[model samples]
Target: MSLRFSLMGPVRAWRDEEEVGLGPRQQRAVLAALLLNNGIRLSNEQLIGMVWDEPTPSALMALRTYVYKIRKTLPELHLKSMDGGYTVRAEIVDDCRGEPLEGLRSAYFDAQRVRLGDYRLKVREDCLERELDVLELQKHVAAHPLRERPRALLMRALYLEGRQGEALDHFHRARALLNEELGLEPGPELREVHARILNGDLSAPRRPEQLLPDLVDFTGRAEEIAQALRTLPGTVGITGMRGSGKTALATRIGHLVKGRFPDGQIFVRGRDVAGELLRAVGVENPVGDRAALWREKARGKRFLVVVDDVQDAATVRDLATPGSAMILTSVRRMDELPGVTWLKTAGLAEREARDFFRKVLGPARVDAEPEQAGVLLERLSRLPGPIRVIGGRLSSRPHWTIGMVLQQMEREGKLAGVIPSDCVAMLAPLIAAEERLSDPERHMLMCFARQDAEVIDSQRAADLSGADPGEIEMVLESLAGVHLIEPLVLGRYRLPRFVRFYFRLRTPALTG
Candidate 1:
C-alpha cells in the first residue's frame, strides 16, 4: 500500500488513504519534520529545535522518544544518521502545501532537492535505514573531537581505498585535533593503534593510480565551458572549490579548442609556462630573454596555454604576453588581472552528480542502489574530486556496494583524506593569504568554521565575534574580496564546506 504523510493538514500519516497511528501529536511532528526535509541532513540540535519550537536540555531525549514511537508506527520509514546529522529518504513524497507555497519538492527544499519531480520522490529498494543496528554495534563512539573510533574509521577507510598516504595524514590531524581541543595527547588506546599503522603492521591493500577515471558524461558546466571557449586569446579565470573541476574543465577545453591554435597547447602550474611552450614548439633552450622570446614566438600564433591552480596574481602577471591565449584555473577569481573573464564554478546538479557516479561505477551497479547513491552524492557534496576519488575506489573493488561506502563516509565526517590530494592542496595558498588578515578578522572567520549555519549576516557575525555591528559588514566584504568568504543575498555570508573545515583546522591556532 502507498504511504502518505501530510504537513498541510493536521500532521497525519496514512497508508493507502487510511490514517496510520503516529502515536501522538508530538510523535507525528517528529515524523513530519524528518520526511519533509528528506535528502538534507539535519543535526540533532536542529531536529530537536524543529520537533518542538522551544526545547530544553532534554530535547534530545524527547526527540529519540518520538523517533522510536514513529518507527514503531511505520517500519518502512527511512531515517538515517549521516555526516554528523540525520537524513530522511527522498522517496517519502510531499503532498503538503503550507505557508511556504510549494508546488514541487525543489520549490520547498532548495537546500536538499537537486532534481525536480511530480508529487513523488525517489528511493531504492534496498536503501534501508540504520544498516548498523544498536545491537550489532560492539562499541560506542562519542562526540569528543579526539574520539579514537572516528579517526580510526577514517584512516582505515582511506587505507582500504588504497590511499595509504591520506590515512597517514589523517592520523596527524586527529593527533593535532586532540591536542588543540582537549589540551592532551591521544589516549593510550589511540597511540598504540597509531604505532601499529605507522609501523606498517595494519593490513592495507594498495592499488596504483593507473586507473584514470574517464568522464564520458561531463555535465553542469556547459555554459562555463562555452564561456572559456568564446573568450579565447585572453586569460579566462576559472574559480571554484577544490573538486569543482577547474583542471578537468581546462583539459576538456584544450581538447575541444586544440584546432584553433596552430602552434600547440601547454599546461603548467607556475611561471614555467615559458619552458613548456618552448618544449611544445620543439625549440631547444633559446639564447636570451625567455619571456621576450616566448612573446616574440607567440607574436602572431594562436597558441593555447593553460595555467592550473594559480595561487596569486603574480603567476598570471608573468604569463601575460600577447602571443598566445591563456586559460587560468584557481580557487580565487584573479579579478585583478586585465581582460580576464571570470567563470565561477559550482557543484554539479544532483541529477548530473548522480549520472557521474554511474559513469564511473557502471550504470547497472549504480542503478542497483540508486537511493544509496543519491545519499553518497549528498555526502560528498557532489564535488568532482571526491566523487571521482570515491567512485574510482569502488571501481577498483567491484564487490563494494554503494551503501557500504556511504556508511564509512558518514562515520568519518568528511573523511580527512578519503579523496585525492586536490582536497588537501586546494586551501593551502588561500589559507596563507588568510593569515594576513587582522586578529579580529581572523577570529570572525573562525566563527564561521565553528558554526553549522552557512548563511551569516553582519548581525550574526557581530554577535559571534563580539565585534561592532558596523565593523562586521566591512570585514565580511574584505574576506569576500579576497575570495576567502562568499557573500550571499540580503547581506549574508557563507563559507564553503571545505573552506570551513580548513579554517576549523586552523581555528585552534587562530584563537591561540
Candidate 2:
C-alpha cells in the first residue's frame, strides 16, 4: 500500500522501493495527468487534452485502453471512476531527478510541462530562502529574473550580510527590469524587501527589536515617567526646554515597557523618520508613497515606537497605528497631535540632581564637597545636560575638586566654556537649536537678552525691540514653541538661564 510518485523528472512510481512499470509513453502521459491531479477527478475530455497534442478520431478509445493498461500495471494505485470521471490517490514526492515526463513528446503536454516546471522552481526557491544561499539564489534569480520571491530572498540575504547598497541596487535593477519586460511593477514581496533596504530595515518578515540603550545613570522625571506609562498603548508626547532630558525619559519608558510590546521596541530619529519606521517593522516599500505601507505594517501589531527629538508634529502625524503605542520627544508642546497625552519635562529637583551627580562622579567625590556640589548644581540650573557634562568632566579629572570646577565655570563665564574641550560635543544640541532660529527669531532672541528684566511681557519686548506688540507676541510664541524661552504666567516669558548665558557670551555687545 506504500506508493510514491514523482513528476518532477521522468514520471515514475515506486511501491515499497520497487519500481513499477507504468506502460508506454502515451499511457504514462494519461497516468501522469492522473497522478498530477491526485484526489481530483478527471473527465474523459480532460484526460484526452493532457494525453494528446492532437486527438484523433479514436482518441477516446485509446484513452480507455491506456486507463485499463495503467490499472493493470499498478493495481495498488486504486484509480477509480465516479461521476463519469477517474480519480487516484498517490503521494507525490518532490524528488527532482529529471524533467517531468522525460521522453514524452506531445504538444498537448506542453502546458502541463510548463506548470510542473514552475512548481519545481518554487520548491527550489523555498529551499533557497530557508538556506539563505546567496550565491545559488543569485544564479536562480538571474535564470528567473521575473521571480519576485527569490529576488526578495536575495535582497534580504544581501542586507543581512551588510551589503545594503548592493541589495538596494539590485532592487532598482529588478524594478526597472520588471517594468521594461512585463509593463508592470514589482509585486509586494520585492517592494517590501526594497523598502526595508531603503529604510535600512534588516529585519523584515521578522519583528524589529530596537531601542537606544537606557541611561545607566538616568535621573529624575518620576512623575513624567509615571504619566507617560499611564497613557499606555496610546500616543504620548514629552516636551520640555532644551537639555531637559526628553530623549532620556522616552528611552527609559521604552525600556520599562519592553515586555508589553512583543512585536518590537523601535527608536527612530533624524530626517527620514517615516522611512526608518517602515524599515523597523519590515514593511515592503511602496512604489510612490510610504504612508499606506506604514499603516499596513503597523496595524494590529503590539509594538513600541520612540520618536525622539521631533521638531514638527506633521512629521509623525500618521505614524500611530491602532494596536501599537508611540512616544514622541520634542523641545516644544505639539498640540497639533490628536489625543496625545503631553508631559512637559523640567529641570531635575535638588535631590535628583545630587543623585545624578553621585551616579556620575561617585558618592565619595560628591559627598566630599557637598557645598560646592550644591553651588555647581545651582549654577547649572539643575538641568540634566549640563550636570551630565560637568559630572563626566569631574569624574575623569579626579584631581580637580568641585570648588576648582566652580572656579573654572566662573573664569570661563559661559555655558560653552564651562564644558571641557573633549566634552564640547554635549553643547551641540543647544547650539544647533539656536542655529535653527530664523533671522527675525534670532534678532528677537538677542533683543530679549538685551533687557535687564528676567521675564518680559509682549509690551516690554515691543518697547525693547521697537517692534509691534502683536508681532512680538507671535515671535515670542514661536521662540517658546522651540523651548528657547519659557512662557510664564500673564503672557510673560523668561529665557532659560543657559540660553541667556550662551547668548551673553556669544553676543556680549548686544547685552552691553
Candidate 3:
C-alpha cells in the first residue's frame, strides 16, 4: 500500500487504505516544518530553529524525541541519516504535496519570462484551449506548487496575451483563495492588471496599476445579481436592512462584470462626501492637474461601476452619468437615481432558512428528527438572521434538545407577538389569503410595538409581558404557526427591522 501525509488543514498521516494519527504536538511541529520546507533537507539545528519562536534548552533532544515518535508510529516511513543530518526520502515526501498542478503552471510562466516569444505563443495556445487569460495562468500557478510572485506574473502574462475573460477570473479566484489561506489579498499589481483586462484597455505596454480594496463575501443574492446582469447597460439595485448583504451583492456584481467592460471600471462608496472622482479609483486627494486627469482618464469609458450603500439621493445624483453600467444597493429605496432596474431582497425562504439552520446546527443534530426541523422553521418565521442566531446557540449548547429550546421559549413570554396578517403582508406567503390575529393576541402584539427591544430568554419575557408561563407558551406557539414573531432561542425572539418600524407607528396610542 502507498503512504501519504496530508497537510492541507491539520497535519495527519495515512498509509494506503489505513489511517495514521499524528499523536503529539511535537510530532505535528516536525511534520509541519518539513512540509513547508519541501525538497530541502533540514539538519537537526535547522528543524529546531523553525519549530520554536523562543529559545529552548535541549532543543536537539526535543527534535530527536519528535523524530523518533514519528518513525515509531509509522514504521513504513523511510527516514535516513544523510550528510550529517536526517532527510526524508523522495517517495515519503511526495505523498505530502499540497497543490500539484498549480505549482507546475507557475514554473511554466517563470520559464516564459526569459523567453517572452515562446511564452506568448504558449499563452496563446492556453487562451485557445481554456479561453483563459495569460495573467490567470499565474493564479493557477500561485494556487499550489508556485508562490505569490509567479502567480502575479501569470496574471500579467494573460492580460498581455489578451485573454481578458480568463484574466479577470484569475484575479477573482486569487483574491478569494489568498484571503482564505492568508487572510489577505493580492497586491495592487494584480488588481490593476485585472482592472485593465476587464475594461478592455490593457495597453500593449503594461502601465502602472492601482491598488484595489479587498472583496467582500457575496452570499444569498448571487443568483439575483447574475440574472440582472444578463441585460447589459442596465441598472440593478439591492435593498435590505443594514448588514443585510446589500453592499456585498453590488461588489460581487462589480467583480463579475469586470470582463464585460474594456474601457474602465469604477468603484465608489456613497459616503464619499468630497465628490471627488479620484477617491472612487482608490486614491485619496489625487493631486496634480485635477480637471485634466478626470477628462483624460475617465471621459467616455465604457465600464461597470458599483456605488455602494447609497443613503442620500443628492449624493447618488452627483455620481450618475449616461455611459457605463451601474449597480447600487441601499437600505432604503431612492427615487433620485432614475431609469434603473430595481431588485428587492428580503428574508430567505423556508428551504433556505432550513439549509442555513442545518449548516449552523450540524446535519446530525438537525437531521436526527425530521419533525423537529419543521417545528424550528415554523417558529423562526424563516428569517435567516434569527434562524442563524438560534441555530448557532443550539449548536454551541450540544446538550440542549429541540423540545428544551421550544419549552424555554414558552416560559419566557416571547410568544404571540405576531398576528397572521403580519406574516402574510411581509413574507409574501404562498397562500392567496392572509391570516389574522385574535383580539387577545392583537392586544399582545400591540404590547410589542410599544417597546422596540430585543427578546431575551423566557424568564425575561414572562417578567415583561405579565403573562404566566403556560399562557405565554401557548400564545407563542399559536403566533409562530402563522409567522407572526420568530423564536430566537429558548425564551428570545426578534422582529425584522422593517417589521419593528411598522409596529412602532401602530403603538402610538400606548406610547402616548
Q: Considering summed lDDT, which 10 consecutive residues are worst modelled in model 3?
A: 96-105
Among the numbered candidates, top lDDT falls to: 2
How well does model 3 score by local distance difference test?
0.55
Alpha carbon lDDT of each predicted model: 0.62, 0.78, 0.55
In Å, residue 244's CA in model 1 sits off its true spot by 1.2
TM-score (all chains, Cα) for each model: 0.49, 0.58, 0.39
Error of 1 at 91 (Å): 50
For 387-453, candidate 2 gives per-residue lDDT tens digits of 8888888877879999998786555554432444653554555677876787667777766654524
C-alpha RMSD of each candidate structure in angstroms: 30.9, 20.6, 22.4
Candidate 1 C-alpha lDDT tens digits along 351-470: 889888888778998999989988777655677766777787788888989998766544443443233253344344445566577777777767777674566688878877777877
Q: Roughly what TM-score does model 1 have, to 2 decimal places?
A: 0.49
The per-residue C-alpha lDDT of model 3 at residue 429 equals 29
Tens digits of per-residue lDDT for model 3 on 1-512?
A: 33555443355666544677877665676765665455578888777766665538987788888888877876655665567567663222222123221221223323423454333333333332233354355444744521454455566566667666666777788788888888887887777777767677664521112213434322355457655664335577776544344555666666655654554566667465323456544445667755355445444444466667665766555444434566777655665577666776656666665666677787788778668776766655555555556676687789988777667544432333333342333333222112245644554555665576545244655566788977777766555433455677765666544344334444554345
Please give the RMSD of candidate 3 to the true structure.
22.4
Per-residue lDDT, model 2, residue 46, is 85
lDDT of 1 at 412: 41
Worst 10 residues of 2 by lDDT: 414-423
